[model samples]
Target chain A: MRYSKYFLIIIILLSVFNLYAEKPFKYVETGVNTNSWALIPAGEFHFGQHQHIKNIDYDFEIMITDVTNEQYANYLNEALEKGTIYAKKDTIWGYHPGDPFDAYLHEWEIPAGDYPHMPINEPGLRLNYENGKFSPKAGYENHPMVEVSWFGAKAYADYYGYRLPTELEWEKAARGTGTNDYPWGNTVKRNQANFISSHNLFAKMFGDVVKTTPVGFYNGNNYDGYQTVEGISPYGLYDMAGNVYQWTGDDHPKVHYRYMRGGSYQSYEYNLRVWPRNSAGPEYTSMSLGFRCARDID
Target chain B: MVEWGVKDITVKLLGLDLESVERSGRIIMLYHVIAMIVTSIEVYMITSIVPMRKHQRTNINATITVGWITAMIFGMAFAYFGHNYFYHGLFLVGQSLIFFAGILLAVTLNPWNKHFLVENKEYAHTKNGYDLERIAFFVMTVSMLISAGFGAVTGSFWSNGHETFLAEDLIRQPDKTALQKSIIGYLHIMLTLIAIAITLIVGRWMDFKGKLHKFAMPIMIFGTLVISGGVWSVVWTHMAHTFIYIGSTFVMFAALLLVIYAWGKLIKDRIKEQGLKNPSFGQKFVALFHDPIKFGPFWQMVFMNFTVSGVGIFMAVKLEEIFRVWPAREERITLTGHWHIPAALIATIILMYYIDIAGIKGKLRKWLGWTIIIGSDIAFAAMTIMSMKRLFVTEYYQTPLVNWTMLATDFGLGIILILLAGVLGWRLIDLFRSDNRWSKESASPELELERTAVLTKQGRDVIKKEMEI
Candidate 1:
């Protein structure tokens, strides 16, 4: 009787996390936008504003803009259709038993936990899930996909056979081979990137309520009469230093956190420097945070 | 800013002994106005002004999507808990969602990314001036953030100050200095932004031109920023008087630039008239005063921005001293009228623009437009005169003439607004109920297209004649 009760308890806990969430268990090849990749040559690049040197042995492809709400919305619908993900309690979750835990200090493990890709509801959330459908809010489809957890960003990358660039690769892309302070150049202006108090139109229009600007918003163009300069890296990657912090794949030995590079709309100019870094646990999300993905050159 | 929490207190019931201008009420009211009115209007402005891509519009829609929830929560909190932190918390959320939409709207409207300007060499450096309206709209967005920041701070940190929901406080409690100052600053910045938006709209409609236009933008932008920074700093009690003066001077200077630009247009017309065969001075002068289809002297009248902003600054800076004066009844209304004047101005402008776009018969349109313009000016002038009662010897302020003048203007403005509403309402009904033959919406396609074609031909003929000359 005692053994049977223990077994029942185990089953109940497993059901809570949806441990048996159906996984595609098959490779989901390519991405929604297959031709958006900008190639970075395989070579050494002075990383972190030339504070150090780093090298990548393989050429890589990265996107020009942060993954947007519209893209994420599209992905969520497709993922639901493919049964690679499931919606429960207002969250989109999937089966991901990728990490190996070794009982290190503060380390956690699971045989198979239903990892949440994203909660459908959060403050400043740009994507809405209603009536079994996920849709990007109107007028915000191009804004960076935010309020998404690191696992969510990773899930998106995985579905497309892309990987979040490690921090070193990110640094390489932003600074290129130079020691520049910003992605565009050594010097920065108030409107160079969408940082706090930059008084960019987004800052002005939304008051303190809204903060994020659209992806690739820094590309050289005069929005109306307001002139904006492009913030592309030498590798043809855009938004390498600002817009939103792009999550990078940098799992430590035991920690559940993933690294995010590039200062966000809420960050200051200094935070936007090519060398700076910030981090959060994989399940963490925010209105001021988002991610882009990269793939090894094929 | 007057609190309307007292269920049935009409304008006639204004307490005689209210001390300072109530500010939390203004915050509440502004929060109310933004959710109900400003957001939709701004969306219209963004859609009308910005040539956006389908993707950008979709993204903007998402920002607005969040705003709907934010606004719903706000409506509940404000309706049930107007005097509590719950209302404020929801306001902050709505502020974020709405403001985000605005920023996104601004970026999309900007044409540089579209390469539209570069592709058409004539797009930039036009003979009239650069299309600087987008820059103004963007700056206005910043002001939205700055003002809301002040309001949120006041609402959050000094929650106790706004706890008193009685309409009678006029918020005169000395202990609420932080609250009053912060909200006062908030009101000023937003008012300045409103003026900028109006100026941009009118300037474009009037084809305001010359080197004066160039000077106006840079100077106004600087003035606006300086004022925003200074007013915000004053809220933090940073050399409050110094910033007040500097901010006031720069803003006034900016308003003066707008005024000078308007007058310059007037002068240019007069000079050209000197060379005309008939020199129709009387007609030109009348048109300048209230021309719905062309340049008007109302641009000059728009200088009321300076007066109101100065009043906003003076009231904030001298609140302590003003309170010490143990103000009389008439003085209280003057303070009330300080806000009332600008409120009237913005409404008048809205009506004029409606007249311009409503496609009403020209004579009827002119009468309606002129009534608002001249009526608003008269009401403002009367209010300004009554406010001057505080400067006169106390006995003179109590004269029957002064009392009657205040009553007259207040009633006059009410009647004018009522008249406007009646006409506008009937017109709207007529429009909705009319057959496809007369409604503007019905005429939007082929009729509007034919009108545009005729105008384009006339324009081309004028250009051709100028070339011949």
Candidate 2:
């Protein structure tokens, strides 16, 4: 009995020794710049359409970065496979008498696996391109996917139980804590961001073009270092100016096509301004468009 | 005449709207003084009382007293200077001396050592004088020191804000420029997490042993350290001085009180049973007050520790969020509110105490203990919710009076839990102390009992190692 007590003590001592010597698991280094996703301490910041709705305010939590390939893939796979749609048409009646299947239905293909769950023309879906469909055979998994339609992005988010970043959320994250005309600041620079600063549209062919670099590639020069590649925003989101234009959930009349902010690598310098609105058709998926995602606090 | 007071730096840095730092600091000092006095008295009792009665274990009592007193003095000095490195160094030296002495005592005191082993080699059956207790003690002590050293070096809390002592160039500001603030915040947070990890190890050690005593000591020590640090910081610093001071002091007092309560068991043994049984009420009262429950467990010791510790931890979490905002809010990784695990463990200990008793037999005792455990769990959840609501929601305005009232409610809940736990522990201890043969068998018989005892000893050794005691 006495000997057993000693034995038990020895076992306990050994166990304690083992616990003390243990170490924690290491997170993988993705090599992606994290500046755009820098943490904003808990506090309030102004939110709204900076130019158009100057007097109005709509507060929302914004993501520091766009849904990366890793996070987006999870949502895309889950939502598209299960066939759950977040947005039904907000119109009064089910459909117009002369409409074919449904305008919304025609815009999105939320089949089991083939399509994303976003709105057909939403900018978020513009970033879900794989190897051959969007670009030539130069697609890196870590690189943002492009060519997904707006509905495709919304459908993908809805399928996976997420929503398109509302205009308020999107702008807040993009222009974090600042009223900048672009993600970096009011003034634009050539080397600081990836927009077509030289204003030569015929400089490079589509296939032979300089491909978009990974997010936060130019983080060193980000004006605030708290948001994106060009850095610094009122709500602290990256790439809000020039990396790629993002489509918000809201429709705008000034932007006759769907609205796209954040000028792409192929865009002219003027398009890089935060207030400059532009859009593309639902079927058109370009390499110069991509998006970020946001979630509700609750 | 005014006693020396620590500057309320916590309020300055954290920007608390309520409570002045100076007032909070004084309260903290009072608690510290009370705890120190209680601990000293416990040390005195361990030296003077136990040895006088338990004649067979006189040597053990003497060694424990000397070791404890030395550690306490060393720990106090270290706390006074706010130098963890020095505290750790002194702790190691004191613990080593105790270990060496224990080993010597085990060998010299063993009767078999003189008769066989070293003196006679002709007897083939004779073995080397390997005292398991000695080996376990030494191994456990060394392991404790090793783990503690690792925890101190690699641990986050040790590194957190230690830069204050690191270099003249490196700034240790509660509030710095945004750039400097981010860096400091990240480092400090990381360190605090590491300290928490180390503390969890102490809990894990207790879980491994299943013996309440082994785990209790480490918890007490950890609680004491945390409490002392909180008290010191509340008094000394200017950054976040008032908010941190009040919150930390509450946490500190709770921890110290728990340690004393757990140790109250030792005082109980000395008072109720050891000091000439069947004495007068006055004599008992005198013993109780002098050799109070500071360094040992009271009859309901385990539960008191649990409730105090559990609620203290929950409150501490709320306090932490109030003082500092998470930099990674977008990530949705809020680091707070993990006190439930310990609360559960404490409840388990109390229930187990009841399980060991004969008075609570069959399904009824099991049902009662379980009911208490479940009830306590519910209370804990409610406490957590209340604290969170109080801290996060601006609509629920908590004045100092209301806050104190809520805190008192938490303490009240804890006391109730302790009462239930006490019922169990008291019953179990009663069964053990009795000459109840059937009850003894029910607890564990012969080989099973031996195995359990051995395992407990081994488990304690491992726990000591884990604690870096």
Candidate 3:
């Protein structure tokens, strides 16, 4: 009877090993393509499923894919050396100005000081810092950098003179002037994006790996026999509705919480809608939380 | 930019619709599955029942060739997923060796030349001295020859098209007329001829020696002649539909005659049984016609021939024309649902044959045939109807009420097919593991007849070499 616990542990260990052993499909993420940018020009579009029209007079550029592990690792190394960021015992910490609180009904003030950006000690963190340098785990270099809190994501964007897109900017970049529910048009077929239970090619080929796909994975191609649908947004942005929930720049007036958009891979598809806004504290982070950067045009 | 299945560039250069090739290319796999797995196994079993020689050498040669063909074709199925077609063209050469085993059967059994001796009695391959099957075999052979010749024409068209049009670097549509004609001829010959041959030959296996079979020969011969000669008649006369109908009608008429002859004999046998003496009204009604429950492969094949040719295609086509259903307008859903009738049920027949080879009797063998055969035919028929549902009906079918009904129907069918495969696998486990219960049976001439029917050439050789020592 005592051996049963050992047997269970052995079973779990085997399953976890099986999960990582299935190397990701090449299309899952072009880890290198994260540097590419898409320009969303000034326009008024249906802001949500309710057709609330909103306009922007200025243009802005945004990363086409999520911030990949390699991109963030490079940022971490630079920040560490430049003394812009520092590490605690098991987490990389960064400073943030506290969020405002109206103290309305349930609103509590988020007085930020030193906050943990990412917990580097966990198994799920794909970027590792060692030997006075930060490097992405081998073979996971192109996957979206997860375990990133709103603060960590903001710090990365600010380090590069970019900012997390406001909710308006993120929605415009994703939905465009098109009155469609998704980044593409009306329909969302399996494997078109990497949301939960998408049964994308990697999921179909190796059933064990339920982890994140590499950024920009759904560009249409038939590999061997598996097929994928083109998944770029209206303005050429990729993974606008999946991969990870992007931390947006908005700190709501009395909500005291940061805004997130484009639901993560762990989210049910309804949360991926352009108007279906998700929010969390500035310090909150999870395996499904990550962000991209945006900057205004001169 | 065409987004599904292989392009089949060779067929593409011919100016034919690539979608048709992609969709219909799968039908050949069905035909060959029937030819190799079910029909070949049936032929082997029939060799024991027929009035033929032990056919030691013929059987040996067949064991080697068939074993090789099965392996190659099985490899071809997987190779397709890997993008290797026709086993990189080697499968074409390898599969043609079936003709070699067939010719050996013809020569040794000598069913064509002399009567074979079975159990010290003259078991004539002929239907009580009728020559219809012989004529059917001849017709099938000539049609096959025409198919082969036109296959060459198809190849030549592709070769020439590759140089003249495909290689010229301009993307104008080449004339696909001649290539279409060749393909049409090849496919028509194969389908119509194989159907005609199977219809004629299934009767003789039951030893049905009736005068009705004598009349079926001429009608079928005329049908084969019209189809073989009219392969390209559509190009000149533009009456391909009329000619195909005339040919098909004759073929169906011949099959109807054979089916009547068989059922007539089966009813006669049941009526002659003494157990029905002074029977009730139900018994009298049953005596009037044979019970479907007691149906073996022969009876099932006869019923299959009638329903598929006589009723199935007729209704499917009528529904398509009159109702404007799906599969008629849809490119992917095949209108020829009759293929599914044979493709699905013939596998059940293979299970029955497996039971016979294993000599496992009682309830397992007794009820397995009728249960599977009845379930499969009905389920496939339901599937054929559902596939033809209109777009409106299909949309409505997504409703909870309709979806639940469909789920029940699907689960029922799923159980039948799963049961068939499960039973087959259960039997195969013994053979594959070689518990030696099947392998160590004593070698008598009777045992040789049974053993040779089941074992491979290597197994036969091992037993023969052991006996010699």
Candidate 4:
């Protein structure tokens, strides 16, 4: 009876040790299985300008890519059904209604009849629709969602039990412990981002092309047929330099504007620099705008 | 040396891309040749047609012709050298030479002196107005020379700052000092201001010439206000908002009123004096079949206005593209005015010809002139109102169109368009009412005799006899 008791105690100790041995940096997938997240280990990182460097600490899980159109559409539809959200048709700047030449107008709507749902295996869809429905263009299911306001992004994050990453957090994820000029490093090129250059080439290759590329279409190498793995950020975040500008948690309430980080397909090379600051009105929406979400680690 | 950004901005403002710079340079070289030919003709006509009372005429003519020829040769040589050297400074030197040649031609033409000597001998003894005008002209010439000299030496006219051709670089480096802050730059600015002041004085002197020169003061004032406003925006960036926005616009509106009144008076006077006698319906009809070169001034004005308006339209379109984030309505209306200016100018030319053939005179002439002027002004006013509404009433900060500099530029363009419409409207009225119709044969007998004398002196007996017949 004494030997059996000793064996039981050892087994209990082993069980407790196993519980403590669980990995700190766990990989978490969204409940809807729409996106993957990486758990960033707790650490302090230097942030801000050289003259006013800041050390910030955080342990959080961040989305691997910007929220995709299909994911947003799903969230939007569910919210509408629950009477938690509503879509309003408003005239966007630079877009004239009934003007055939005005290509900037975008209508936010939920997908309905005849509009094919994004495939589960695809990244996400573009927000192209007719008759007030979210009908993404064919083959654009994997593209990053854009034309979403900061409020909409916030709502999406809240619905998913996440929040927009702070500027420091986003920068830490992009540049890590180093002071790189870009997410990919000091140099920026066409393959390193889906910027104006890439869009130009895409337009040449395919007539009447959409500006944004599929999320994670560039896998740290071979972007638009060019072989290079210099685009990936330190934390394995795809499109840390370009694709669509990501909304950050930072805001200047006095100015009524919020900070946006990374860059978009419409961004110039200089704008894609990691340290360059950009902002817009919180209510503003543009074709080159989007967001990702983050959550605190327990 | 010009910074790349300044060069790019200049090119953009001129509605050209960097890729087209070399082509434009080539075209400018060609323009030098054409200018030389035209200058030569002008020199010949001025020396030959204007009867010189003294033996000094030969010396004056010889000096002018030689000076022009020398300037042209130097310009051509410098242009060729610049093309080979691929230096923008060298290209500027060539352009400056051509510009100097034009200045020399203007000096030789001496319109004020000619008008004083040939048209008004009665006031010669009093000579106060004549003396003042001469002094003003002298000051204007000297100031213009000083401005040009300073501009050339510092390369301020050619480049905005340190030579670079990329606009992106300049925008990225906003703290970099512009050449305009330097000594030579300041001198250029000062001289330009002096020239403008002298031009105003000259306009006042011209206005003293009774009701015939009524358009002088308003046109000059309008031009001065527009130029000063532009200078204020560019040089005194801090004051652009208030000074240019309100002051310049108010002055411009007043100038427009003056222009309309002056033109109305001139047209009324012409109508009271009766219509031109030459260029009978048959003559006008046959003149259309003649070589366009024979019509000279008419074709010249048409071509010049067309070229200028075409350039304006091009600039407006490019500016619209640059400010693509802004609402399109204001830009569209501005562009429409640019297009309409040339069309209206052309239509006025045709209408004047028809009025002459139809012998439309008296109350009809006055009414027609007023209708054209007032109609155009009303249209332009409507456009201005629309542009103003878009500029001031809308919430521009919500989009990417919140640039203060661009807003200022648009405002300036809108006011300038209004001023332009006013000027063109006056010119249209003047064209229809003027005694100097396209066919000089319709002129009064006394005027015809004076023209024949001038033609005979120029050794054009064939034309003089044609005039007598």
Best by DockQ: 4
- Specify the CAPRI tier of model 2: incorrect
Write model 4 residue lDDT over B156-244, tens digit each, in one string.
44434334222121221223353443322333234233323322322231223343233333443444444444443444364533443
Candidate 2, residue A80: CA error in Å? 4.9
Candidates ranked, most accurate by TM-score first? 3, 1, 4, 2
**DockQ scores for all predicted structures:** 0.01, 0.01, 0.01, 0.03
How much lDDT does each candidate structure score? 0.60, 0.40, 0.60, 0.47
lDDT of 1 at B156: 66
What tens digits encode model 2's per-residue C-alpha lDDT throughout B1-469? Answer: 0111332364355432222212222332233233323322222222221111123234544564465556666655444434456765665455555544444333433423322122222111124533222222223323333333332343233335422211111221223333333232333322332223222222221222223333333443344344334323332344533443454344334334334443443345557566576767676555554421121122223343344445555645654343222111101111223333343443344344324323456565545544454445445444454444434533113223234544654664675567666765666676666575447643432211101111234435655786795
Of 2 and 4, the candidate ranking higher by lDDT: 4
What TM-score, to 2 decimals, does candidate 3 have?
0.48
**What ranges in model 4 sit over 4 Å off?**
A1-62, A87-139, A166-179, A200-210, A221-228, A249-261, A275-281, A295-298, B1-242, B246-469
Candidates 1 and 2, the one with greater DockQ: 2
Interface RMSD of each: 27.5, 24.5, 23.6, 14.6
Clashes of each: 28, 82, 3, 20
| Tens-digit per-residue lDDT, A1-298, candidate 3 | 9799999999988875565554534434343366889999997988854567899889899999899888999999999999888888888898988887666643555686888888776556777677978887766777888878888999999998999999899999999898777789755656777775474445565353446767887788664566778887899888888778888898766554566788767555555656666666666666677899999888
Docking verdict class for candidate 3: incorrect
Which is the leading candidate under TM-score? Answer: 3
CA-based DockQ, model 2: 0.01
The model with the greater lDDT, 2 or 3, is 3
Off by over 4 Å in 3: A1-298, B1-39, B42-64, B67-78, B81-86, B103-130, B148-176, B184-192, B221-237, B278-281, B284-331, B334-336, B349-361, B391-394, B397-413, B426-469
Q: Over the stretch B282-309, how does candidate 3's per-residue lDDT look in tens digits?
A: 6655664443433454455655655465
